[model samples]
Target: MLLSAAARRRTPCPGGALLVVGDSPRVVVVGGGPGGYEAALVASQLGASVTVVERDGVGGSAVLTDVVPSKTLIATAEVMTLVDGSVELGVRFPGGAGAPTDPGLDRPGGAVTVDLGRVNERVRQLAAAQSGDVRERLRGEGVRVLSGTGRLAAPDRVVVDPADASADGPADGPADGSAGEELAADVVLVATGSYPRTLPDAEPDGERILTWKQLYRLQELPERLVVVGSGVTGAEFASAYDALGSDVVLVSSRDRVLPGEDVDAAEVIEDVFRRRGMTVLSRSRAQEVKRVGDGVVVALADGRTVEGSHCLLAVGSIPSTAGIGLEEAGVQLSESGHVEVDRVSRTSVRGVYAAGDCTGVLPLASVAAMQGRTAMRHALGDAVQPLKLRTVAANVFTAPEIATVGWSQAQIESGEAQGEVVKLPLVGNARAKMQGIHDGFVKLFCRTGSGTVIGGVVVAPRASELIFPVALAVEHRLTVDQVAQAYSVYPSLSGSLTEAARRLHKAPSVAG
Candidate 1:
């Protein structure tokens, strides 16, 4: 229900007279992910006393396990893949055995083994260090770091359960009990992020069968890895592990890999995966995963079983939005269990807001940060506008890294956007040839009549970074001729973007 001007005027701030008379209100944020931490900082800057309650470390799963660690591991994998290609580049080792083995690169079957023990240790260390930095920064900004889980006892009150071990006199346990501290606040920010989703039948054992979280725990690489799900997460791990020397089989329920991404970009990666000896299983649904002797068996819906030494399920993630008083607070949730919030992140319940993956907005850190900031602006009586999805840029971190921003060809063809698509292959680029990279393209979609760029796709090494200019063009309604005029380096891969735009300007028309 939308509030009327009279209702808004009568809504009382938690601080009562002090808040009404222009005193800063106390704002409590639960969860320390990007959304939570960013909101805490913003609220404190706006002169609100802020407290962040976190069960896990401050950076949440994004920094602690998912994005940072996975990207770092990908970096290592990239280096190894490049080194493996050295033989073709005339970089030879004596006796054809490659260079003298670095103990770090040595793994079973003469492949580069990621020392997961060292990797996990390093990942945790980095996450912890980053978390500490966030905590200190929040403290500097006058936001209290409350280390515990937070529960909303009332619409205007939150209760924090402190670490259990602190009161138990340090026995085998950390601490035992406390009544818990209650905090009264004007506005509550719920940014508790998500976790890896698992199935009851294919539950992870943290050993042979695992989720993305348990990947860093291993000391040795698997002999063979079978990845279930063909979405972004599944594709990323499959690509990374294949590069890391695991004989990988990626099972996809869709006709192609990365169903959510640009169809052409997904096809390119799928083709590359096939060429690299990673088995691609399309339209295969894994019904269950059971542990067999020394290996895991994946039962498909078709009565066929695929056995591998290890199985990693990457179906998707469920929002972390239960048992935190959302229902009691009357916050509306979607049918899929996502918190239903406006573009500015206000929940159905007054004085409550949500951001990040919980709201089921685009699951990007950038989106989370934007939603959090917008929520605070709306709640604090600042001039606010609802979010515009048109400007969002997203990237899939894969071997070639698929990045996209505005209009999509499929959408245009389906009459969603009456646009023309111009695709430019990387083989025509001088730089791609010089770099020994030949597989990728730059694709641009624009309103045929107006010549304004509406969407674009970049499929190349560092495509994530290169797609931004195109994204900006789409967001700002820049024309193909305008983009073509911009100075791209003489011999760079990014030149393909401008060239693609130039080509789109030359195109007469598209069916749409």
Candidate 2:
């Protein structure tokens, strides 16, 4: 709801009391994840007194467990992949086993190895430092940082429980709860993130059976890791572990891996997975997973069985909304338990906004941050733009990464989007050839008549970095001629994007 300056409600300033005129808005942000903290910063910048309440940590699961830790571990695995290819790159370990890392260069069964303990230690430290940085930054911005679970007492009132001994967030209060503090708010933001989706039959033991969150606790890599679910999360871990010398078997309920991603890109990744010795079990579903003695066993719905030293569950995530006072406060929740928020991030209840996974929007940190800023802008009566999922770029960090933006090929095929598609294999790129990379492609989608860039996909070693230009074109509605006119570095993978655009210089009569 946009309001004029004269009609906007008075909010809290630096002073204690919240009810008054000609002051900042009292913004209480619940959950200190990307959505919460980013909203807090925006609220502060918009002349609002902000407070962040979190029980996990300032960075929430995105930092503490899920995104940061998994990506950091993947980084180590990526380094291992690079080192394993050192010999092909004209570099070799001198005298074989003389190097440090306890026979790192020459493992009995592998060419390169990673120390899971040391790698996880680094992951933990980096995540903690990142969380600390957020706390310090928020405090510097004069935003009150409360380490506790926040509950909505009313639409305009938030009560914070002083963190107990079990919480792992920054300490802004005593460990033991002596009492609770309540704050009046002109606007409230709920950014409580989601947790790993689990099933009754497939429980994580944090040892042999584990969720993605429990992967970093391992001191030794799984000799045979069976990963259930072939979605983005499963594919990523399967690719990472395969690169890091694990015998990986990926189980997919769908006929192909990455069923949600680009079909061509999924094919490339699946082929690469097979070529790299990782088993791909398509059209297979695991009914239950259980620990049997030292190893874990996964029973298939088809009466088949898969045994592995460890199992990683990467099915999906559930919103962390239960028993959080949202329903009690009259904030309407979806059947899936996600908060129902409009594009502007406003919940059903006025003065209450939701962002991040809780809102059931695109589950990306970048999307969360954007939703957060947009929510604050709307709440504070500032000029704002609603969240645009079309302009958002998404990347799957596999060996040959897959990055995509805007309208997809499937959308175009289904007539949901009108566009012309041009696909150029990265195997033909000069840089890919020079780097000994043989897989991946660059596919571009543009409006048929005007040649306005609509969408694109990149599959390469670092496709994440390469998708930005395409995303920029799609977001700003740049023409193919404009993108082609722009110079990409010669002998580069990015050149393929422009090359694909150059091929689409004129609207095609049909798909080519």
- Give the per-residue Cα lDDT of candidate 1 at 139: 79
lDDT of each residue in 97-118, candidate 1, tens digit only: 5543532122233444466567
lDDT of 1: 0.79
Name model 1 segments beyond 4 Å from true: 1-20, 94-113, 162-179, 506-512
TM-score of each: 0.89, 0.91
How many clashing pairs does model 1 include? Answer: 5
The ten-residue window of minimal lDDT in model 1 covers: 167-176
